[model samples]
Target: MTFVSFLRKNLQKEIFQVKGDKLIHVLPLAKIDKREAANYLCVSVSSTNDVYITLLNVMEEKTVLKCETRHNWLLKDLKLIDGIDQLQDNAEFCLHFDTKIFNLEAYSTASKYAFLRCLRKMSSKYLQYELQWIHFDQDFVGKSHSLLVPDDAVLSMQICLEAFTCACLCSCF
Candidate 1:
């Protein structure tokens, strides 16, 4: 059998597959450091070819790593969003790594939040930031008053608005 077929067949087995939620994120492994013993199976199978896998099982409270290399990081080490760019939100939100990491395209708003919720569960409490969308009853002087941002970010905006209001009131006299 071809390597592709062999991999497909093996991946279907229960040993390789774990039961849990669908992947919240699937970041690629830039460097796959494999043991010399791992090379015994086939000459064609190189460390570079193997796509390392990291499974985030939120319900089970574990992150499983099936990397090309033997060494793997547990949930605690992996889940902390300490890096400044660990999470990015634009048209889409991505967790961990800026480049070459897998894209988690959450089509619906609910799905996006579900994914974020799962991510928050996996992350450290301080590092976790919930995503929220804000909507005002009406636009402010025709300017759009709708926004979607992290919960922590809203605090600063609120403070700035309060300061602006106070300054305006003081100046009015």
Candidate 2:
């Protein structure tokens, strides 16, 4: 099966299970200003080992927002007021993406801790490599290394490596 289909099937099966109920909460982070209304924040792990956070409309049982922790995603704790006059009592943490941000609030302290632990655990599994380096050893020169390299330098190095790999492959044939 295609990856999308597999993900959807796994999400449907895991998100509706009895254990998934614990992850459901009325998160006030919804676009609607009605804090009293019930909205669901659901976190689930797909069969493919991907982590997903979904915001649901409890009344309609429909997803309002869904995010996967694969690309350009960050989870942070909203501890400080950061000059805001007041913060919501339930406002405990937030999930940040490249284009969107979700302020997450839990039903209780324990729930907040649990969610944080789960998110952190999942997020830590994916590591984005910022730079690549190649090492050469010789008798005259033991080893050489580059330090404090800029982003452009790293990109150039990666491009050079790719070009070298392509050249070697072409020469072999």
Candidate 3:
């Protein structure tokens, strides 16, 4: 079988694939045409290639990019990627991440303030992270987060992301 076919077949397994993520990457998806329900995303290849993958209607996903992408210890440069010259509003990004989780519950409010209060309750209270996205699943699913980020006590974004990460981590693991 061809390499792509092999990857596709393996990915189509009936049982849940126990894929271990030693490295992480991100994919940016955008909603362009509603009638066709078409979407476009830029996924990186091991931090080597950053190419654009287009979907005509969810099943017709094909890569039209010429570059590669990969995971990096530092923030990957978006300028290096070819297809991301411009960004659309409400673009959805998928970032691969492996992080610790304890608990993330809300009773009163779902705002950032309430979120941070719960995160600080963790025993490992100071884990850092970058803002990736919120995840919800049927089983063994909660908010998904990137790795704990570096220290930054100044920016408001840092405060919010860090808190949400901690809260989500507490609930997930």
Candidate 4:
């Protein structure tokens, strides 16, 4: 399997290892607003409490995984690659960039889908940036390793690039 897939599977397993505290917020549902989507969207984050968010740039060999004692992921810039339903009944989604990959999970399938929808809507509306931030990593420092691309991945990437180019050309008026 590709490194990204392997990391994704392992991370999914690790995320399930934790069953967070059962503390539900008591608030009324408000009208969905694009401006408020970024902050209002919430999900049950997984991984151990000790694991802090880490942003790594593999190609540049640069990282910004540490800043303060804790991080507010809602404030950072991120992109959701694969939406929810990658795994049935297991609220999980994948995020990636040119180098890094982030796996996030919610409590249930409903919450997972809801979070994914809100995130996609918000991102498309406001944060049109590429997926360059890494928000979930256990070993912050060592997580900056270079991405491994095998022969299959290279071929798949070529195929995808060709398809994308064709689509772009066809769409041009």
TM-score of the candidate numbered 2?
Answer: 0.37
**TM-score of every candidate:** 0.25, 0.37, 0.21, 0.29
Instruction: Count clashing residue pairs per candidate.
Output: 0, 0, 22, 0
Position 56, candidate 4: lDDT: 20
Candidate 2 RMSD to the correct structure = 20.1
lDDT of 2 by residue, 1-173 (tens): 85333434444555545334223221223334554344545555544444556665433226542433232211222222111112222335555454564555555433343344344444555322211111211111111144475323443465478789999999999
Residue ranges of candidate 1 with Cα displaced over 4 Å = 1-91, 98-100, 125-173
Any runs in candidate 2 off by more than 4 Å, and if so which?
Answer: 1-37, 60-91, 125-173
Query: lDDT tens digits, residues 84-125, model 1?
Result: 222333223333443333333333322243334334443423
Weakest lDDT window of 10 consecutive positions for candidate 4: 21-30
**lDDT (tens digit, per residue) of candidate 4 on 1-173:** 85434433433343323344211111112323534321112222333322113322112115312111112244133434464343233445565543565555443444433333434433434445333322222121121123574323343455478789999999995
State residue 2's C-alpha deviation in candidate 3, in Å. Answer: 31
Native-referenced Cα lDDT, model 2: 0.39
User: Which candidate do you rate higher for lDDT, 2 or 4?
Assistant: 2
Residue pairs in steric clash, candidate 2? none
Report the alpha-carbon TM-score of model 3 versus the true structure: 0.21
Better model by TM-score: candidate 1 vs candidate 3: 1
Report, for every candidate in turn, its global Cα lDDT versus the true structure. 0.32, 0.39, 0.27, 0.35
